[model samples]
Target: MMILGLVRWMQPVHGYDVRRELLSWGADKWANVQPGSIYHALRKLTEEGLIRAVATEQVGARPARTTYEVTPVGEDEFQTLLRGFWWGLSEPLDPFSAAFGFLPALPRSEAAAALRNRANLLRANVASMRASLESDWIRNSKPVHVGWMFELWAARAEAELSWCEQVADRVESGVSYLPAELENAEGWSAWREGGAPLDADPE
Candidate 1:
């Protein structure tokens, strides 16, 4: 969604150009957009009348290039999506992290499965981020600041990997899970102050 908005802002960008821009901005670290996904989104948006492709123009013996421009509706949708992105960032708990945070309340089998899934994802992401950091494009850069950005990305990936490892350890140990109702109750107080379940199931 955010990539689509950025493409709309930089009207007439080619697929390769969009891919390069996303890499340059470290979008891979923060979002899941890829070249194939970008192409899909572009086609869908165009078909929906959110964007229109300008006629391909030739500069030399090379093949012509298709450029896209956003319609007014696209502009409106972009703004709305951008605002929602910002709002989500303002929250303290990221959705993925929050799931791990509440693992103690989930069924033991389900929690273990979720932890394993998250670990696998983190492993893949960390490997990819490390590869990017070591790539010639990053290493051969003359700008000290840009080179440091790749280092930063690697560091962030490592942090996520560490968190995943910790979660996996707890899950493998068969740690007991507390009911959501008792999660926050003090040991003695919970014994004396019994009440209804903390969370009622929705019908």
Candidate 2:
């Protein structure tokens, strides 16, 4: 997604230039963009007719580079992806976590079943991330910054799995709903206290 964004930002950029910009953005610290994946995405986009490749001549010993430009189709797709990314970040809680938090709104048996299902899904995701983090492709030749990002993602996945287990335990123990009084007045008060202040009346 970042690569696509970069391509859109710099209309005629080559693969090497894209790699350089990734480093410039401190992507190594905050993002994971393997060399192969970068090349692969560019190739895939070209093949899909989403981007056009133009050959540029070099002056010195450097070989000519193939610069890429996003097509109209690519621009529309990029905007769609960007909107989804922003929406996911702005949500107060992840969908998976939110389901667990509001399990009381569901029937006792059904909620318990749903909690177990989500826990299994989370556990599988954690294991998959761990395996990817430990793979030779990621550990050996990949840059330290990129590897660190994988590690960070794996850590977050593990933490989420732990939370899922805790929720499961609560569900299994027959703790179904927050008390009506607590759900109403207390919950509303706590929510208002933590939220941003309301705007003053307009003069």
lDDT at residue 199 of model 2 (Cα atoms)? 38
Model 2 RMSD vs true structure: 12.5
TM-score of 1: 0.49
Q: What C-alpha lDDT, on a 0 to 100 scale, does residue 143 get in candidate 1?
A: 48
Residue pairs with clashing backbones, model 2 = none
lDDT per residue for candidate 1 within 85-189, as digits (tens), equals 767765345787765555545555566677677667767876776786678867764444566765666677677767767766776675444566755655523
Worst 10 residues of 1 by lDDT: 188-197
Cα lDDT tens digits for candidate 2, 42-156: 9898898778897766869887778999999889889999999868765344576665554444555566666677667877876876786677756654345566766776787
TM-score of each: 0.49, 0.48
Assess the local accuracy of residue 26 in candidate 2 as a C-alpha lDDT between 0 and 100. 53
Q: Which one is best on lDDT?
A: 2
Per-prediction backbone clash count: 0, 0
